[model samples]
Target: MSQRRQLPMPRPRELLTNSSHFFAFGFGSGFAPKAPGTVGTLVAIPVYWLIADWSLPLYALWLVVTFALGVYWCERSSKALGLHDHPGIVWDEMVGYWLTMLLAPPGWQWMLAGFVLFRLFDIAKPWPVSLADRKIHGGLGIMIDDILAAVYAWLAMQLLAYFFVG
Candidate 1:
């Protein structure tokens, strides 16, 4: 048991397997019993701080790669958990929130807006987003809807920027 406890955590791998199961999961933020999506979105704030210094292109590239890979990991982990889109697999939210922030002004206002828009779009699931959420299942299903939500949030943020930001 000591050995098991001491074992290193898995790292996020782009391959079909080997993901930073816990870290990629926002330190288990996805495991919330209720409002898992809400928890997932909330956990993304600090991630933004950590990656704030990186170039936008790099951050975008990393998010894209992670989302693409998360399709499988999320599905597999969900399956393993005997649940579909378990809250514990919140890597999807992390990537999506990052996507939303990429378009923002990178300050308190933008962070606040990104948080609100991402959560709203994620929960509202308008148009094809709703369709995708209901029709799709498994990893891609979990990841895609959030991706769409992020896109919507990003657009909304851009609109706000146009109207509100200088």
Candidate 2:
């Protein structure tokens, strides 16, 4: 019997050099096999918690910096990997989730809602979100849906917080 040849396993990491690279790989959360976007979004929670006390403006600053830079890094990493919007690319999840978390109660209940809502909008890509997903390409495509999802989640949170909490 002839011996079978085995292919080497692919490394989990995609080398990230700059802000774009970091966002492209979901800050390396893309390496996870299962629930990559969720994992990537989850990874962002602690960072959010750390800056939990900072002014909203500060967080906003960070968000802008990442969003502006991500357009290029995400595209580069996705192209290099030979896949467009690969599951491994979860940087969009991280930023999107963070944006969703913004303006929420920050408690378990609200945070959990935010998480679910963000995921749903992200996966479904309703309305303009779908447009962004299909019409856009490269990093913009990878991140735009998540951005819309975040916007949806944030608005939903506002409504919920007002009606449910008050």
Candidate 3:
């Protein structure tokens, strides 16, 4: 049996006090005892709801900004934690989920599907995602795989939306 080694836990005080840590941890959702990535993505749902109605251009702008900043914060947090791609560094998850929902037809059903597909692709790390995860390093490494997973999930959701909901 393969056992995953846990990353050292960051204290709530440190996470809350440091802006980089706060964002890297997904506004504290990464503090969850289990599945911090899932929690972080879950935390993104409400934020998505708030902005889902915005024009596509605006949403794309937000995504770009978040991702560009993520590279920095993820790197900082990973350095502080002394772990690369720490499970607790889940800003990638939050952004990835948002990317998955971009331009998606509005509905609770589509949201749920996007969530599931995003988590699946993120965890599964198929093909290019796996390659990026294994070969890349630092914050870009951490964020790229999830972004690719988001792409996969987005495409899958689009297909499913077309076939099942069209």
Which candidate ranks first by TM-score, i.e. highest?
Answer: 3
lDDT of each: 0.76, 0.76, 0.92
lDDT measured at residue 135 in model 1 versus the true structure, 0 to 100: 93
TM for every model, in the order presented, reads 0.81, 0.84, 0.94
TM-score of 1: 0.81
- Candidate 1 has its poorest 10 consecutive residues by lDDT at 7-16
Cα RMSD for candidate 1? 6.7
> Mind giving the per-residue lDDT tens digits that candidate 2 earns over 82-145?
6677777788887888888776775777767878888888888899999998888888898888
* Candidate 3: residue 95 Cα off by (Å): 0.5
Score residue 123 of candidate 3 by CA lDDT: 94
Per-residue lDDT of model 1, residues 5-97, tens digit only: 333333334222535456445566754656767787888888787886788789878897878788867876666556676556778887888
Clashing residue pairs for model 2: none
For 1-166, candidate 3 gives per-residue lDDT tens digits of 2133456767889987898999999999988777989999999999999999999899999999999999999999999889898888999999999999998888898889889999999999999999999999998998999999999999998898788868
